[model samples]
Target: MFIRIDGKQVEVKKWDTVLSAARRAGIQIPSLCYHPALETAGACRVCIVEVFEKGWSERKQVTACEYKVQPDLEVYTRSESVLKTRRTTIDLLMARAPQNAALQALSKNVEYPQTIYPPVADAGDCVLCLLCTRACEQMGCNAISVSGRGDTRKIEPPYGANPDACIGCGACARICPTGCIALTETPATITIWGKVFERLHCVTCGAPMMSIAYRDYAVANRELPEDYYTQCQECKRKEVTARFAGLSMKVHHG
Candidate 1:
């Protein structure tokens, strides 16, 4: 497909979003809550762009992550209206998460000035992008979710108590842009939200693999083989190698 971005013509493939096209054209657009591995959420309005059709004189502002590129479309990644909207959005995000390093980096990218709005009181560092929850769901854990609405919103386990499904995989924490989720790992345990999960060790080599909860969770989801959890990676490799060696010997003798 062919499109015009900042008055420059660019070529892209089908199903490519404006963000992907901008990336291909070497244009930098700040975005959060958008991961290549996960779905396009458009939770953060930081990637707003102005778009005009080939025959249309009016341009409309839209989220770049969710807007697909079309032939003869004109896209402006840094239009004045887009910058003003981004500044407002960034300022609000900064007010909501003053200590968030990701927000700080975004502020620099958009040239956001010092926030005029007062910081929210008692607001945790979570930007509420739902990236963490989406990531957990994609990993087949579905252990965490957003609770409440508006000002009282928070990321927590369902039922507002200890999570019954958390496997301590730390995928949520790793995908979190604000780093609100805390995951502490030791040789024997992995802890999150005051829940301790015992890390399972290999039966053959006694090497640590992952938390028992994760193994159980995977087993419940049928993501692992019946005997897959019995050994660590190294031991599994050795067992496969030994079996192949024995098979080769039997074939030679026969």
Candidate 2:
């Protein structure tokens, strides 16, 4: 198939998407949701391209990442229609993540002139870019997914807590363009290979215990592991003994 991108003619395969074809011709198309390893979700709508057929009367704005190339397809990556659509998409995304450095840089790259949009609510900094969702489903992690719908959508772990199957690989956090997923080493209570265990003071005995003890407590309490439970040395000692002895003896006798 013959494709014309940015007024340059190039040969393209039938199954090649417009983005890929543009890449072959050394034309740059700015995209956030398009990843080489993931399926095209067409969520961001940022990589819009104008497509025209030899016999068609009107050109169409299509997502370059999702639109397949056809014979005699004329693709314009920077046509007025494409630019206008992309600019609008960028503006919406910027409004969603105004503090995001990557989004700010993307706005500058597209030369999107900002206009007044509605004030963003106190929402978490997720652009719904689908990187986390794609990674979780496609990469065998299945750790996060979009919960809620529309403006309330958020990338949440299973049951709004860290998934039991999560290997803590940080793939979702790495691929996220907006800083929505916050992954940090904050004395996790789980134990696995390559994990360094720290000593959390036992509440009763003033003895050092596994940091994972907090996780054990959460599991026993049927609570999410993300919640913090801490007991200093003396308090942990009393609580542990109270379980075996009477509470009065453990408290008054101690």
Candidate 3:
């Protein structure tokens, strides 16, 4: 099917959203909570766009990341209404996360109305996009989740529960857009989520790689062997290439 975005018709495939279609057509849409590697969490609402349906005379404001494209659907990515809504959203996000680098970069080109609402108390680094929690879940470790309600909500392990599910893979920290989740690494350990795990040093080069807990998880569940995981990635590649070259030599001689 095809949809018109910003007065240009773009072809869309099955289950394609406005955000994806626009990206394919070289249209840039700002989003915070959407990651292709993870499920769509339209919590940010930063990618809102005005939509016109077949019979609807009025444009409906919707999140471009979650709004599936339909035939003859008209989308205005930068219409006056969209710009007003998005600019206000950017300002509100800036208020909530005043130190967020991404929002700072966005503000360089986008005008802000500077809504006078006070910054959320104890807001910290999290914008509550839930990407960290979602990534942890997708990584098969539900070590953390959203807690509390409304203004008190934050991401952490469940109350009274330890972070036993965490493998120290740092997936949450890696996927978080706001740098809310962080992992500290040392020569012999990696610390995160209130836990410090032993490092898995590569047997070949003695280089610290993933945590021992991460190695255990990958070996047991990701169908990798312990011996292979013990080697550094570059060393492993070199070993494999050498073996392949030896086999080729044997074949050539035979």
Candidate 4:
């Protein structure tokens, strides 16, 4: 089938969407939610284009990603109608994700003139791009998915608890564009009275030790054998005391 995009003729397969045809013909269309490997949801509506039929019908806006090309169809990707719809769509997206760097950059290029929208509420660094959900499902983790519907929907781990399948690999945190995911690790420190206290794990016992206590008791300090660092807290204490007492007696006798 043949379609005309911006007055240029392009060939397309029977079921090819306008987006795929334009892309194959080297035309650029800005889109965020249309991943080639996934089903097109048309949720973002950023790829809308104007379709013109030869008769008295007015040009209509349709999402290029989901609009299948018909034989002899004429499409104007850069028409005033298409540009207006795209700019408005971008403005709405920016209103929802003002802090999103990608969205901000896109908005600048698209010339979304009006800025009267209210500030996004507690955005949580999520632009709702759906990348996390795609990763979870496609990567076999299924560790995360979008919960709720519409504006209330949010990405959540399984059952809202840390997924039992989570390997702590931090893939979700890394893929997140908004920095919303909070990955937990061992507690590291506490601040009190404007002073920061460091937490120390005993090399031998794997138990939490007070950094101040370890530093103050010199007699309790002794270097363990390289392999002894894995021993428990009680074992480390006994080893240190035994070695220190022996050394004290030898020095006194000498």
TM-score per candidate: 0.85, 0.70, 0.89, 0.62
Over 1-254, each residue of candidate 3 has an lDDT whose tens digit, in order, gives 88999999899997999999999999988898899998898898889999999988799999999999989999998888888888888777777777788777665535663535577788887888899989899888899999988777889997936688988989899888888787999989999988999998766667789998888887898888667576678767776897888732111110
**CA lDDT of 17 in candidate 3?**
94
How many clashes show up in model 4?
4
Per-residue lDDT of model 2, residues 158-222, tens digit only:
67864765555456777888766765554433232233344454443444444453345445555
Candidate with maximal TM-score? 3
Candidate 4 on 8-60: residue-level lDDT in tens? 99999998999999999999887776777767778678888988766736888
Per candidate, the number of residue pairs that clash is: 0, 11, 0, 4
Q: Sort all candidates by lDDT, best to worst.
A: 1, 3, 2, 4
What are the lDDT scores of the predictions, listed in order? Answer: 0.84, 0.71, 0.84, 0.67
Candidate 1, 1-254: lDDT as tens digits: 79998999999888899999989789888888888899988888889999998677699999999999888889998888988999899989888888788998888877875677888888889888889989888987788888887767888999877787787888898888888888888889999966998998887767777888888877878767866687778777787798888742111110
lDDT of 3: 0.84
Error of 4 at 53 (Å): 4.4
Where does candidate 2 stray beyond 4 Å?
113-115, 185-254
**Candidate 4 TM-score versus the reference:** 0.62
